[model samples]
Target: MDVDYELIRTREVRSQKKINFPDKVQRNVSFEHRAHGESVEWHYEENEGVAVISNDRLSDERYVHIKRANVMDDGVNIRPPNDLIEDLSRPIYKGMTTVYLAHEDMLEGDIRSVYLLTESQAFTLIGERTDDSKELREVLSNTPRFLPIPE
Candidate 1:
């Protein structure tokens, strides 16, 4: 079956709040949902990237991992640069019963982009660097403004 997935909306994930957590607990980045969709699928292109979506805000230790790729049963995917992918996967902290989306891709891995959907807000992580939180925040704050408010 062929599914024509349309670009319903797109928003640059940015942290609106800060979280204080111990080093052991993996704290993911946070962002607000400027747009909403019931069955929305997120698409991104990177080298064997894995996106982890969690509802930890509602339930502790609950997450869904998605491999961001370009090819799927349904033909829908966007080829984002490695730099961009890494930028999108920064760690954020906030509380809003939101959904979290995180991604990680190795330097020498297969190049596949994929997408996933959720019911609430989510955080994202990419690459394997744990010391780039500051850089990620700067990148998000500067370029690529948020998607315009929908009518």
Candidate 2:
């Protein structure tokens, strides 16, 4: 499907509190809803190149409430430049939002770890959501013979 992938920023916070632990965290914001119609999640990401969402996607009764930000020790070393997926696209704004709707659910996780984001640290992830959304409707309007989009 023709999915309009976008990242939307609803709010931004410069945390006054800091946490020191296994890893360092910059900023954190909590969302009210779950990803796949169930389960809550906590997104753990770095201020640099590494972002990891730590949450339990297994249970329907649990929802993640991002308590606060954390400060941690220095992380692992870098990888070869060639091994990295270089995003040469435009400069993503700090509070800019993108929406991608689809006929079927695209994002499997309620929480996503965004890497190499030079701007905002935390924001809402909107894409291939409901069946009747604009994203899904637009994709259904066309047909592709080439095959599914490349990874």
Candidate 3:
């Protein structure tokens, strides 16, 4: 059976840091996507003072680092950083899925490769230097309810 997914809700959570960076604040924004028989929660944390930006999927406890970049003079060029790829693939095994998350600018014939994430797992590669308008919309629309949300 074909399952249809939809974004159901979004929530923002904020908290004050008590340890090393007492003056800094951390923010977590969550998005919930649901399908006919399943749902997934995805969220990202932002801490500007420490330059920490990451995403996590509440389901499988998988998390990844988001590296942001700005538009260059030439154009909106995007490629997953080698370090991130290495880190994500460190636990490489058979049937592992790699999903390339790119800014909209990088989607127009700029993507070098495409990998499918299984219904049970997935990861995101965010481009910090470019605008994510297209990528954001596409992700919300195409992401399945079973893929792990970035934490």
- Output the number of the TM-score-best candidate: 2
Full-model lDDT for every candidate: 0.25, 0.26, 0.25
Give lDDT tens digits, candidate 1, residues 1-151: 1112111123332243321221111122112224521112223223223232221121112222223222211222122234333534432223322222222321112222122212121222221222345554343233222111122
Candidate 3 lDDT tens digits, 65-132: 34432212222112233343344323223333322232222112311111212112232322122234
User: Alpha-carbon error at 118 in model 2, in Å?
Assistant: 4.2
Locate the minimum summed-lDDT window of 10 residues in model 3.
Answer: 17-26
lDDT of 2 at 129: 42
Scored by lDDT, model 3 comes in at 0.25
Ranked by TM-score, top first = 2, 3, 1
Candidate 2: tens digits of C-alpha lDDT, residues 1-151: 5444323222221222111111211122122333332122332222222222222332222222232222222321111122121321223232332221222222334533222222222211222244343553454334341112345
TM-score of 2: 0.23
Q: How much is 119 displaced in model 2, in angstroms?
A: 2.2
Off by over 4 Å in 1: 16-47, 52-151
lDDT: which candidate is best? 2
